[model samples]
Target: MIIVPASADTERGRPGTTQQFADMQAYNDQMLRAGVFVDGQGLHPTSRGARVTWADGEWSVTDGPFAEAKELIAGFTIIEVSSREEAIEWLKKWPASCAPDPGQHLELRQVYAPEDFGEEFTAELREREEQMREEAARAAARG
Candidate 1:
């Protein structure tokens, strides 16, 4: 998962230009052709969202637009690669299409598979997870 930390445009609720979308689509198409791109999407600004927090056994809700732009996520992309280096190589190609600014940065994170948790992720858990995923796929297909 590549996390796109928030930018000024996201905080300000500014929309991207048509050319930016076209450029990104071209890059995404290339990745799709290479069989690396699995999924990707952009998010609306924080002004339309909310946060629910649990702390000290208490629950609280905070409405946006949130103040901390750097901590928010404006978008994300998921890719499958054999190594971190390969992921970085793909990341390097992103900026060319993204029209990034000097302050813009992205975070690369590996998604955790059930195997990563070792025995703590028991067989029962894996089975349940697989069942859920299948159900989700079926629901999507129905739609």
Candidate 2:
């Protein structure tokens, strides 16, 4: 599985919020048709959220309601691909307007499944997972 992180530039976007959502919807539709993405979602601004961290015998908490757009994490997507090359290919097709500017960035990372741990139980777990996914796919197709 590949994870794609995306953020919107609320400060410098040219097409306005409505247009940005429309563009995102269109991009999602294309991804659905491509059959590579397993799931995706857009997120609310950081102003509505908070962050928590732990230190040496201490807990630190920060309130949201932040105004700095650059520090915000907007949303993410998970894609199932055969290889890194395929993942990169799909990422290259991400909509251009998703970012605030040409330098705006997206981060892609590969997710580790139980099988990656190389434990005896992980083998069985992976087998069961594959079976469940296949069953779910068949069910979706029938519906």
Candidate 3:
């Protein structure tokens, strides 16, 4: 996940520039060519973000930019790699996408697939996933 670290823009707007946009596309192209890229995104600044919480049979709403700098995730990138070490190496290659002023950060995270759910996932679940994947492939081929 790419985290836009806290700065003045948290409240009203997000960060962007033509140079950074070009840089991101360049980096994404590299990853796509390598076949490790799954998906990625950029988020609007916090002020346009929201939080939903539930407790005591009630729900609460909070708008961003949230004050807690560390908690916010500005964007995310999903990739498939052989190992955490490999992911780290790929993440390390992220081009500096920030403007000279507002800083940028990236967090590499392991996404849990059904296998991570252990025994509870069951053979039926695996079969369903496999069937879906096949369907998607067929649809893609048709398109």
Candidate 4:
């Protein structure tokens, strides 16, 4: 996952400024051509979202408009890649015009897939996942 923090929001939707969108489109095209673009989208401000936390064996929900600008994630992009080095290379090429600082941070995080759990994930579960993969393949073919 690639995380865009505060700076992204500051540069968006201004008049006479469209290079950001074009740069993003170019990056998306490059990633797509490389077969690494799995999914990505920008997020709305914290005012439109909420957080549900589970603690003390109870559920608590907090409304947003969160105070911490640095903590709020502006967006995320998920990619399929062969190695961390490759991911880094891709991120290094990100356009400067897309954020307020003209080269704001983009965080790279490794996501845990079910297979990462090793033996704790039973064979039955693996079989179910394979079936689901097959179903997804079939659905894609239908389209």
Q: By TM-score, highest first, what's the ranking?
A: 1, 4, 3, 2
TM-score, per-candidate, Cα-based: 0.93, 0.66, 0.75, 0.78
| Better structure of 1 and 2 per lDDT | 1
After TM-score superposition, the amount by which residue 125's alpha carbon in candidate 4 deviates from its true location, in angstroms, is 2.0
lDDT of 4 by residue, 36-113 (tens): 998778777777778899999999999876777667677778889999999999888776666535344678999888
Root-mean-square deviation (CA) per prediction = 1.4, 5.3, 3.8, 3.7
Clashes by residue pair, model 1: none
lDDT of each prediction vs. the true structure?
0.85, 0.67, 0.72, 0.77
Where does the lowest 10-residue lDDT sum fall in candidate 3? 1-10
lDDT of 2 by residue, 1-143 (tens): 33333245432222236766787778778878888767876566565567888999888988775666555556677887888888888777776656544555676788877656677657678889889989999998999
Most TM-score-accurate candidate:
1
Highest lDDT, which number? 1
Please give the lDDT score for candidate 2. 0.67
Q: In model 3, which residue pairs have backbone atoms overlapping below 3 Å?
A: none
Q: How do the residues 10-124 of candidate 3 rate in per-residue lDDT, one tens digit apiece?
A: 3345456678778878888998999988888766777777899998899999976677665666667788888888888877777675532344456666877888999988999
Candidate 2 Cα outliers beyond 4 Å, as residue runs: 1-16, 65-71, 120-143
Model 3 TM-score, 2 decimals = 0.75
Task: Give the lowest summed-lDDT range of ten residues in model 1.
Answer: 95-104
